[model samples]
Target chain A: MTRPGRDEDPDRLYTVTGGRSRSTTGAETFDLVTLVVSESAPVRGMQSEHAAILRICRFPTAVVELAADLGLPVSVVRILLGDLLAQGKITARHPRRAQTADALPDPDILKQVLVGLRNI
Target chain B: MTSPEISPPPAAGTGRPAAGTAQPVTGTTRPATTGGGTATGTALALLVSVVVASVATLAAVQAGDESARTAIAWGAGAAGAVLCAAVTVAAHARLTNRSLRAALAAGNARAAEREAADNHFADATVPTVVERLRNGGSAETALAEAPPVASEAQRRVLVTLAREVHKGENMRAAAMSACANAAGRVQALATSMAADLREMEHRHADEDVLADLLQLDHRNAQMGRIADSIAVLTGARSGRRWAKPIVMESILRGAMGRIGGYQRVRLHSTSEVAVAGHAAEGVMHLLAELMDNAANFSPPTSEVHVYVEEVAAGVVITVEDGGLVMGEVALRRAEQAVLGEHGDLTALSGTRLGLAVVGRLARKHGLSVSFRPSAHGGTGVLVRIPRELITEARHEERAPAPPPAAGPAPSSPRAPLGAAPGTPPPAAERTRPAADHSRPDTGPPRQAEPVGTAQHDAQGHEQAESGGYATAAPPPQQFGESGLPKRRRGQTLAAVARASATPSRTADSPHGSRSGADGRADDDRAADGRAPAASPKKRPSGARFGDFRRAVQGAGDPEETGQTPLPSASSPTRSSSLSEDDTE
Candidate 1:
């Protein structure tokens, strides 16, 4: 898929990934919610995107977040992450999806907030 | 010097004979030859005349009486005496002429000797002057470096040469300044065009339009190169300047970005040295020309490889292409072109012009460019930059930057210089990540910031950053790691915080700040390939470009399903102004 903002030739991307189009790790392995964390800091002469990934992943980060953070297409991010993964530079784990209702505040807390608003 | 050991001490400054010149020196020896010595020499002439007259009188005696003969002899003697006096004067003149000629010859020889000495002085002095001027060294320093001369004539000659050299320098400077003023404008226009294209890329959400903008961007970059080349040939500085040293890798990437076939060119760098700001542009341009040549001449399927090595002297860049091997004569001609001897643009065809451009740049910066038969059977061109032009990269500068980015030095004179063409980036531009707006091609911005480790940076970034740094900073740090692609270290806290907030905000509040059917409407608008709504609720308010980045980075590229709009050419006045520059 074509990246949205960028229009550079695939030639640059080809060189970046050493002409690899598929991720070494199964592409399906890195789902949107998958969480990944860097095993180390960025070293000198590391690919800027890779370094950016390591620096940003000082904390666990989701695959989608990594893609957005690096400003790369998810596919490109997967390939780079695959490279890192193969080299043991980072670890990825699938996170179970939490329910949307659980994400909202408790109903009791919501009722107290409504009563407080009425008093004001 | 083969100096005629004759009295030459006084001839130093004048380079002419001192003593005899004090005489009433005439071009011919006859006048100056005449002196008091002729009188005594007349006796021999008088004797010969008397002998001839006696013979004449003897002949007269045979034809007349004794009294007549005696009178004839006396008369003949008197006549002989007068004849002898005239002959003596003529003889004296000749002798004097001979002596003067000898003196003149001696003088000419002595002058030649002084010239040899003057040449000796020039051999030592001219290089010092040239080196000084080329390095932006002071005239006083160059003069101070001139070795002491032995004679007044030497000193005088030196002064005269200095005056002429300075005059030539002034003429060159005047011409360069004039070209610089004009080319600098064109250069600025091209640069700003790049900015405008970027801005449009921000506003437009259409894939087709963005692609078109990229092509326009490419063309603008090429035009900028031509303008910059003209400026360099005219002896003006390159279009852009960096306040701080530029990493060798970044400089290569910057050069690569200028060419149309940049993607086919791959960079392999082992050097970490940075070039001093003054020579950085020259180096970059030189590489661009070489890379362009490599890409242009080689087979379409072939790749151009660049290898950079740091040597004891400085940094060396090798551009090797896998094209057909060049003919010996063709190689020589190409090499000659690289010398840039034919300064007039029309003297060269387009191909030679490219090599000439690179040669001129290399010469100006004191970098050496050499051509060799490549291992791949194509051409291998190596450029060696001198130590003087090279500097150590700052610790932070190791991050790959596409365009030379300013380091810790805040004075970054280039910001204004790059924007100073006519209109600076709009006021708001100054407030954004100055670099983002200042130079859109900054590669290292999305740095794998060695946030906490050194070797980790090296071990992790080596392959990527080396070649990566060599790549133009294509990925904007819009939603970059830590959200602050430009900030690092202690400030990374804020960057990470901002970066974290950015992703969550965009993910949780998809479709911008609007909700319900309106959100769907905004989504429909984006899908329609129309400009996104500019509502105040756009959280990343001024970060419209950022929104475009995420959307363009494929964040929302396809998420806007089937919305379509009537594409309209509605943008800025700058587009027209930009087209005007292209016509020129």
Candidate 2:
């Protein structure tokens, strides 16, 4: 479908994916909210983006959040992460599903916050 | 699963079921269309079409002929047609299979190109992304190692990121060093220019030329100050030094002399104590900057009043201006900086660094600075100089009032007396030998009592007091000894008037005058008896301006030989009011 003679070629999403739409790390798929962290210190001669990921992921950071921080698309972040994960440099885990009922603040904690605010 | 904050089991079991369906679609769709299944399906469809065509041909042939011969001929034709159709189907299958193989090869090549392009894009975008990441934390240095990742592209990106960061750091350091070097060169050039101007002031005995020279000298001081401030901000030392302790009044006047708006500053009370030689330079720079700021920010017609008070622990110099009042935020920021809280350089207003420079100098010298709203509807800055830098040198003599003479030290007291009659007839005679050389710029010449007019040596003290510092010993004072012909004396007097009019050659002036005028040397040594020996690198300009003032004072007397008893009468008061108040 690509026009060969056109001067301007719009970048396709598959270009970032290396024309393979799926992760190569077996059947495991990367979720948007999966958290990732560097498992070891960054080594020399790695791609700058990889080193940057290692630098930013010293603490646990979500896949979507990493994409936002790196200013890359989510799909690109997923691919880079899959590469990092395969090498054992970074580790990823799925985010916990939301449980609205359990996540509500305790009444006692709310009372304490109210007291703190009034004191201020 | 590893992180304590996030629960992982629910996401693993229930999240994004659509993501699962995507994997099977990719798994089944490609092979179903392009693999052996497509080949088998195509073969089966061809077979069915061939069978239907053969049956139709046989049925038509059977219906067409009843005779044995006709049936045999029709059967033979039908069989030929079936063979033709079977051959066509086989050829089509072969061509389809060959084209499919070529398409598959082309797809593999395209995938390789897309992967290469992906790597290229990644390489180009990594540096900007890495820079943003580095700015997020100061602990980036701790991230000295890159993790092990299998992807070669990812590894290269990390390496480029680290290199870019190192390059940026190196550039910043180089810029800072270059700025420091430029500031130092400017300071040196200003100092040398000031010295040369002083030397010129020494040779000229005309009042108007000397006054213009003094003003130029002041401008040079201001330039040196600006350079010094920039150098200090860049973390270089302020290299100015003084040879001996100087009176607080001398320091104040020296600072005042450097500013353009000196006439608008009104001095109130000041301390009698002297500043130690080591801290003298910083004190002078600091006061000059504060007063300069005060004068610059205020309305032209409004006066800035300065008050100094000696407290139990130290001395306080207060400068109050009548400028537009500062906003609360700006005032608070200024006060924080003055009181040792450094604001971000980028946060400071682009127009002014005066406060920042003042704060840096104050912090370096252990001085406390503060800013407050003034009664004058502007701002007041109070700078407190600690007691350590203040020394009690009230009666110390031998510290010449201000080291004024920059010429070759007069080897002995009699040298000037011996040299006066021969030394080119005192500069005033050579240029403008007429009686009415009163400069148009200086308005009317005010005649007053001429002190010690009989000998150049006798008038050294008056010259020091009147001319600031430079005119004390050289040309005019030397010319006073000879009662040359009336015209020659008039020339000498004009030269002397010029010398007297030059002002404020304080502590930083060259000590070269000490050896030339025995009378002034003795007076200086007696004035600050405990003062240390002068530095040899004294700025020559201070001495020349002092000498120029004495020449001016000397010229005034001869021009109005019969009119007034006032000699050293006009300019001396303004200068001595500074020195005299210190002694009191």
Candidate 3:
């Protein structure tokens, strides 16, 4: 484990998220598997954690990995991600629809498509 | 609710003390931080080379043996330089085996390049180059100073000396750089792991698991310090820089947390002091290395006592180990190590590496760390930090009030410590006379007014009331004295006053002694209640000191010194704590 590196103490976690532990319930929410792609490069004088997040998300990335890369808790990273999404600095992609191979396709839709092809 | 890592620390805060000192102060004109006015090895080497070279030149010219003259000068200059610095080189074998062998081989090579060389040279050049190498001067520069010559025996002699010194310096430099780099990488991974542990520590609810994680965290902190030693020894600045000043107590505790035997370390006392943020890391690491040495050397049963006192020179921290005392020779060896004398690799390999680390750090911050025999029969280390590196700790947290009075401006960080009586709080700004009368003039004016001007004070209070409730602040001091026990509360309050509330009124009432006592008791309570929480700016630098003196000095009767605002103000001599002479 690293020794306490309090020297890099930033503006502090409270001020970083405006005391909001969770993302606001609006557009662009984040989940563990949600993907984030940075639209802009990190610039000088940005909140260090935010800059780190921007630099890490060079390609579409997962919220969990971002938390690991930034060395911050998922909750903190979610709040930071929410902020970035709101600022349009990054885009988040939702998780894919869940399904299993055992689940069958609707037979009626398949038959209708077959008849339409025959008619053509 | 206490985490084991957090419990023993004096004040609350995250402890991430880094290792390493700031880069060596840039110029040579200034005395090296290693301390002392005597010339350094580098300077003395130059002086000796010039003197020895000139004497050798004069002797050779008298004999009229031109060829022998240069050789004699080269030999004397080289021998003189080494012998001069050798006076301080405690361990003669400090020069690596590789360098010694190279020098011996160069001597044999020089013997072959005898009479064929006839070129005249600057009398001092060859000897100067030899002196440079022996003093740990860079090899490349030494070679450039006096180049090698195959036919000229004197030049060959100078060339060999330069090459030998280079071999030793280059080896040490390469090793230190590599060690620092490796330690840095390890600390980075450890930092990442520590962050993860912090996260796990929060998510886990099982008491047993949490305890396990705490152990891992402490062990990890110890490892971080070990890595830090490597970087510090290499003379590199590593780790976090604090932007806000950290109180002295917290810095001590942070150092304790980094060592293995922290539990046995007793931080007995710390007066009000704060290290400016930039120098905080170096000071913390320096302390950690010392504490670790103390705790490790002392018996497990005995406690290591640490006392921090504010003195004129700066803050003095005394770390005493209650174990066997260090002998005179050992003490001198350690003193030299910290001062950064001797040679580059004197004790880098053995157990003395810790001392080397301390020396490097002490020099980096210009802190003077000296050792003296302690009363407990163990070694006592005194670390004196210069005043320039400290900022007054803002102990005025509860005093959130905005600046109510106009005279004491906001936050003068270094407000001429002990704002001695010469700059007493302005009389017009205090309006003490007015506040005395305004005390709900309905309260029967409890003060036994020596001057019988209670009515006048009431008028001033009435006028001040219209401007703001400003006059309300002074009444508590007037009314609170008789109602409370004075001594215990008085001293305690004086400590909390942050050196700002001692008005000159304490120094000169007709009842000089009595009013001083009563007014101070009331002032302590009044000041505590009125401390502005929102405006945690600086207070009068010596106000609290003035209060300490007032409380300690004239403990007079409340009735005898009855509050009349003791209109005469600004006598710094009333309480002597106001004088902070920069005495080291």
Instruction: Using DockQ, give the best candidate's number.
Output: 1
Q: How well is each residue in B1-584 modelled by candidate 2, as lDDT tens digits?
A: 12111222222222223223233433445433443443444445445644565566666667665666476646655564455445444544454455456555766786787687666546554544555444542224413433343367665766666666666656665676687789988877876666555345434433345456656766776788788877877777775565556666556766666676766777664355778777777887788888998999999999988888999878999999999787888789888766655433554565677777788888889988888888999999888899999986533121332232111111001011111211122334323311122212112221211232223322432333222222223322333346441223323554455444422222223422322232232222221221121112111211221233343333332233111111121122222332333233
Better of 1 and 3 by DockQ: 1
Superior candidate under TM-score, 1 versus 2: 1
The best candidate in terms of lDDT: 1
Locate the minimum summed-lDDT window of 10 residues in model 3 chain B.
B14-23
User: What is the Cα-based lDDT of residue B542 in candidate 1?
Assistant: 18
lDDT of 1 by residue, B449-563 (tens): 2221121111112212121221222222334466444433222344333433433433454532322223222222222222233221111121222222223222222323111
- The deviation in Å at residue B403 for candidate 1 is 24
- As a whole number from 0 to 100, the lDDT of residue B445 in candidate 2 is 21
- Report how far off residue B402 is in candidate 1 (Å): 20
In order, the B-chain TM-scores come to 0.47, 0.46, 0.45
Note the Cα lDDT for every prediction shown: 0.52, 0.50, 0.50
DockQ of predicted model 2: 0.00
